[model samples]
Target: MESPIYLDNNATTPLAAEVVDAMAEAMRAGYANPASQHEAGRRARRVVEAARERIVELLGGQTGGRQPDRLIFTSGGTEANNLAMFGLARMAEDRYDGPHHLIASPVEHPSVARAADALACENWQVDHLEVDAQGVVELASLENLITDRTRLVTTMWGNNETGVLQPVAPLASLAASRGAMLHTDAVQAVGKIDVHFGNSQASSLAFTAHKFHGPLGIGGLLVRGDTQLAPQLFGGFQQAGLRPGTESVVLVAGLRTALELWHTERSARLQHLTSLRDRFEQQICAELPCAQVVAAGAERLPHTSNIAFRGVDRQALFLALDMAEVACSTGSACASGSSEPSGVLLAMGCSDEVVRGSLRFSFGAQTTPPEVAEAARRISKACKHLERQKHR
Candidate 1:
């Protein structure tokens, strides 16, 4: 039997060899809790802080002087996004009067979308910016959406389902002009794109290491200088008392090693992933004319390809591909097993058939040309098999 092909990288990436090795070494040398008071703790604290400070620099943020951007570590992107939604909103609660206003997109990940829903439940005026058929949010709606009461504007930098890149910089600039801050969920965008936080002008950004070939359970929220964030979790003085907890030096080591490895070959990785994705998509479409790539007109992440099969059921094709050992997805991994059509696609005005037939195939750093070619053939075969079965 041939080796299996794995292309569901947008869900989560396998840890890099260097990241795993660094994490192992950190467990041996810096296993002490960062919050402890002794020398061992200080060593652990140094390890954690090193990752944090480097993240600020890697993401094109500032440090030192009167005010510097801060990176607050968290469990992952979910927690960081929740913190940004709740922390920033409440941070200005005491000083500002009247109902809080927030602007978000209908296509945000469950974390940000649910956070917005939670805020709406609290009597806050939450308005969602509409998205086009390609899953790109309307920038025109934003200028009108911002009023005197608007506090924060939130959107994802790269969509997980369609892989479409959002207009974040211009959105951030528009939001800033209205005295509102922008918070981008850069979980999928950070490693795949040239995401410069300072140049973007977003007040806060959320990202996790697992999305970028690093370990799970560790991520950071970069908050711009002069932007005050209220504490989301209450505990000790760790992470400037914002997300207080005992830091994981081992995981931080994995994150540090992962970022360093990407910096070594960012451009090459981007070009490689783009080439692989294009090859795969072209092969898929040519072999099966029934297939159409979603958001084909929009700029997308290099590693992701969401394609819709015209007359096939997504779940049926997904199961067939899985049995064929070709890994893929119907939509966001977070919303798996729900049996419902993708909300992201629905918000983009995709028809019931298009939404039901879409499958997301995301390549990774380790994906090879042979694997992509084989996977494309396998997918084509699976769809044809399902088509024959339906007729029978």
Candidate 2:
């Protein structure tokens, strides 16, 4: 029997062979706690430090120059984002003047959007940036929303569902002019597209290895070296007490290997993913007239595709695809199992029908043309049947 075609790369990716090998090597070496004074502990610490430096360099973060960036390890994107928001906010507490304000697009990941909600509950003024019909965040809205009181601006670089690329660089500049730090959840963008921390000017950036064919349970938050982030978790002085906890040497090894693979094959991977995505969308639209690709006009990640099949319920389509041995999603993996419509689509002002009918299909670096073709056929068949039943 054939295995189910996995099209949910944005949610998570399968571990790569190189990453598995690196992890196994780390375990075989029996790395000790990085905090200890022994030579073995120092060896483990060196691995973590090397991985940190390499990750920053691979992502185009500042390295040799003044104010080089720092990478803070976390459990995943959620913890990293939380550390960015609450940590930055707390650090800036001594400088707070009036009602502290924050700016974010409603299309942010659950981690960010919910963090904004928590801030709002504590009397912080929160403002949302507007996006267009294609789900691109309007820079003009940021100009109007960002004020002197705004301490932070949060946005996702590449949206997980629609894959719309935000105007993050220009937005960061605008926020900087207002003395507001910018944070971007670059989880979906890091492996799919070229991301430069220095060029992006995002005060802090979050990414997870699992989203890029590495191990789970480990992620990084890149921030300026000069940035003073208050520690959220209190304990020993590991990670400068910012994210104080024992680091996972094996997971770091896996992440380092996975990122090394991407650095070597970045261009090839992009081209392949673009080809697969284009082929998948073409196949779906050719046979299913009601299926419209969402945000196709916007600059997007090569791996993600969101389709809205008119008159077809998203849940029914999802179940049908599951039964047909194809895997996809409605929106962010962190927000899975909710019956609510996609917050991203809703933020883009999609119609009720469009929001109700949309599904996300994200390709992986390992996804092949044949899998895309077959997945498209299965999706077209499922949506066509569901649409017909709806009409009946």
Candidate 3:
């Protein structure tokens, strides 16, 4: 059987060899629980702390300055987001801020959006900022929605589906002016783009390791030193009690190695991905004349391309590509099994037909020109077949 051409990096990525080797070494030599006081445990603790330092350096955190001591490790992006929203929301509520409210974009990942909705069930006001046709949050609407009672503004740094970068700096500034904390879900942007948590206006930021060729089940939240958010968990004082558990030294080591690799090779990798993405889209447009590339004019991530076929069902196209040994996504992988159209597309004012027919193709380090060319050819052939069947 032939190997599948993978174009779904946004969903997850293959582990880098270096990361895998690091994890293997940790599992063999640093398996002790980081919380224990024995010498072996101290060795494990040292490993975890070193990994933290590497990640902090990658994110531009200072060694002695007012950097956040609140690096909380979690299972993944979902948990990080939940910790931020729930912890901050409860903090605001305890302060008696007129039923403290939270604001987020309508197109946020389900992790953030659902957490906000759950908070609303407890009488917290949750408002959604609308996005424009370019899939960007309208800054004016966000400003208009803010009130004296607003306690937090949570938005994503990079959209998982469309890979459209949000205007986080302006939003962070707006939140600061109102004395409301800002949180950005940077899970998709961490290793893929330059993320300077120290310089950013956001009070807290979240990121996962697997999105950048690291091991799964390891992620962290970056909190500013002066942030007032409280811990969500109670136990040993590990991770400042914000996330309490024996740390996974193996996964943390893997994440550190991945970040190191990214720092060393980011510029060259980005240029390569950009060239491949452009070639892939150009080939698709040349072959399928009726296809529309979504957000083509926007400053999208170098690896992602969302396109729509006028009359073809995206699910059918997805299966057809699968049959051709090519892997892609209809939209966010979290929404993969659902029949509903993407909320991101809807927020961009895309018509229902376009939403249902849209497909997302994301490239990564392992994606080669030959694979991209083959995937495009297969997609073009599959789409043509679907169109013919529709007319039959």
lDDT of each: 0.90, 0.90, 0.87
Writing each residue's lDDT as its tens digit, candidate 2 over 257-290 gives: 9889998999999999999999999989899988
lDDT of 2 at 301: 92
What is the C-alpha local distance difference test score of candidate 1?
A: 0.90
Candidate 3: where are CA atoms >4 Å away?
66-69
Q: Residue by residue across 1-392, what tens digits does model 3's lDDT show?
A: 65789999999989999999988988788378888899988888888887787788788765466544457778889899989998888788888657777898988998998898998898888898988887988899888999888899998998888888888989999988998998999988888878888777888899999998998999888777787677777887888677888888888888899989988999988898889989999999999987888888788788889999878899999898899888899888787899888989998999877898899999888889999998888899889998899899
lDDT of model number 3: 0.87
- Give candidate 1 misplaced runs (Cα > 4 Å): none
Clashing pairs in 2: none
The pairs that clash in candidate 1 are none
